[model samples]
Target: MVSDFRKKKLLHVFTSFFDRNGSGSIDKKDFELAIENISKLRGWSSGDAKYVETQSALLKIWEALQSRADSDKDGEISVDEWISMWDEFAKNPSAPLEWQNLYSKFIFNLEDASGDGVIDGEEFSSVYESFGLSKSDALVAFKKMSKGKGQVSWSEFQELWKEYFTTEDVAAPGNFIFGKTSF
Candidate 1:
């Protein structure tokens, strides 16, 4: 069962990220918008190799999510459907989540603007700012998640990613991975 706290956090993700079109559900259009927004953030113009690659990756992610979460085969994932799929995953945190791993890699790559294999504060803040979060708030989140290390490596990000999905503790730094969430 998904704890109420976990559900709140998941709902935050749905509203803040997944439901990009604000249509009360996640669909292909939402992923399309995400691709556009993220590519724009990276300054990848249409027809650019990077833009095309990102579009492919994001569309794959959308397919995976739709296959797993759109239980009614309605070509959309409602909040209830989204929560239900996550609830199942919550039962076995150790289970491999391929789509999630792919998504995490995508985010990590996006944040690692320098391509130096890590995300520095400036890079992190810039990506979050594209998501409509304030740079100051993103820096605060980066500070907490990085534990004052001044940067985050892929391994550290993976752990934080897992914590964000599995931890019930409100104070967990992973709670701010996507920005500040109302507890």
Candidate 2:
């Protein structure tokens, strides 16, 4: 059984995805809206090759999350469904490695404003801030993740992703991937 703390952390992670509307539930409409917002924010366009790749990646993640968690098949995730999904997720943290890899790649691409295939410290800070993490903590995380390089490449980000999901160390830089969580 998942402990309360782990469950809360899992809930925070899951809710972060589909609770875009902040209605306290993940419904089809909310998911769709999130996709729309993300697509727009990421500059996804039909004519762009990156769009197809990113869209495919996104669809894979969406399908995985929905198929695993939408127990009622009504295209909505209730709190109970979230819990049930968390049970499954907690059982195998590495199960979603591909999903996480794709997600991290997409995020890296999104944050690499210079199109140089790397995220500078400032860009990384903005990403953290965008996720509601405090600036100081973002700086701390940036320092930890960048290792004094002041930039993170896609491969480095993948390593960080692995560490984020697998590491139990609260002091690990990966633990702060989502921000400094009191939980």
How many clashes show up in model 2?
Answer: 0
RMSD of candidates 1 onward, in order: 1.3, 3.6
For lDDT, the strongest prediction is 1
Q: List the residue pairs that clash in candidate 1.
A: none
Write one digit per residue (lDDT tens) for candidate 1, span 27-143. 999999999999899889989999999999999989988888889999999999988977777677668467777788988898999999999889998988888888998888888
Candidate models: Cα lDDT each = 0.86, 0.65
RMSD in angstroms between candidate 1 and the native structure over all alpha carbons: 1.3
Residue-level error in angstroms, candidate 1, position 137: 0.8
What are the per-model numbers of colliding residue pairs? 0, 0
